[model samples]
Target: MTQLTLDTRSISRGDGLTDQAYKVIRDAILSRRLAPGTRLSIPELSRQLDISRSPVREAIARIEYEGLAESVSHRGAVVVEIGLDELVAIYDVREVLEGLAARLATRAADDAFIDVLERNWQAHRDAVEADDVEQHMKLDAAFHRHIREGSGNLRLSENLRQLQGQIRVAMTTTVARRGGMPAALAEHRSLIDAIRGGDPATAEQVAREHITRLRESLHDAASAERHHNNERRKP
Candidate 1:
């Protein structure tokens, strides 16, 4: 009996109930509050959200279409379970796209955007100090979003957004095992310095290398987990 806790006050009349429901459910999934493979029942969600079943159904459908959830035999829809291999695959594409974003942002960003990046970096430092993984994840996404949006390429930003959603799903499952946050912070500092220096090539290179390091970190984490599991199973 897995309970899905949702804030009922998040939905309101004439507020595009379907979209609202979708956002609420999506946030829950990303936050791992709903968790992987948890059943998403339309009736239950409607009751909890205090909304009509129709909107809830539509929201679930949209989530399924986004690959966030899938239909199982006799179980209706459940949150999708992302594995390490899938996360690595997503990072492969993300590396290229994010590199391009960093290059373009460096070329096009103004002083105001540089200031924003500095502010974002400061907040990220605070999150790391507090050891708030969730807040750190949020700030990390915001930091990337700022760069992609600064790239002045709407299509690229949209594609990255889709990829980011999948990344969030995969990350929630293995984030505990991944212990490269400090390394990531240092890499981000390097990228920001490149961006501030107006060096597009350096920015792109640093960004791509950062992602490569992250992908490697995933392999290291998975390997360590396997070793731990093997030790635990020893007689």
Candidate 2:
């Protein structure tokens, strides 16, 4: 197990310990700083974060609810691993919600909204050019989130946030396999054009296709990783 030192000074009395701990752990998990299957020790985490084990335990419980961590009988809490079935399921959900978000966003988005989307898409492209996978992930997330917000459906937006957590895990696997960002950025550009043109059908089609391609790329990457790991284990 890898240990991380949390900044105690960053912890404040305002939001309570659990919330602060939750945010710290959640961000690490999402950003892939804490990779999947990493065993989490409450005592070690409590000492590192300079908090009580109760709050650390509470934070871990919330992570479990978010599907980012799992509790084992004797192993305690560990970051959840992305299985093939889980990956497929997550992409399937994204395809539906993203398609709906694009369709709804087209119905109500103003020129300003489109402009924001375009700017975010450009940022993603720039990140890709720089070969900054982390920045590319952040910008890519921003682009999709912008669409969800522009959709004008609060419930849909909330649902998309929940769905995004699962998709992010799969994305980490994909990034490990496919090292380039141009193809994904180009797909984003295509989707943006469809949405900006106010063509709901085209927007939906593009969104679906984009997610489908992501799913395929992630699957290939995961398979390759498995093969590599298997080879490493061979005598």
Best by TM-score: 1
Off by over 4 Å in 1: 129-132, 172-179, 223-235
- Candidate lDDT values, in order: 0.86, 0.81
What is the per-residue lDDT of model 2 for residues 30-90, given as tens digits with 9 covering 90 to 100? Answer: 7767777778788988888877899999999998887888888899899888777678778
Per-model TM-score, in order, reads 0.87, 0.81
Per-residue lDDT of candidate 1, residues 55-151 (tens digit): 9999999988888899999999999998776777788898999999999999998999999999998998898888877788878889999999999
Task: Report the number of the highest-lDDT candidate.
Answer: 1
Inter-residue clash pairs, candidate 1: none
- In candidate 2, which residue ranges exceed 4 Å CA deviation? 7-9, 170-180, 220-235
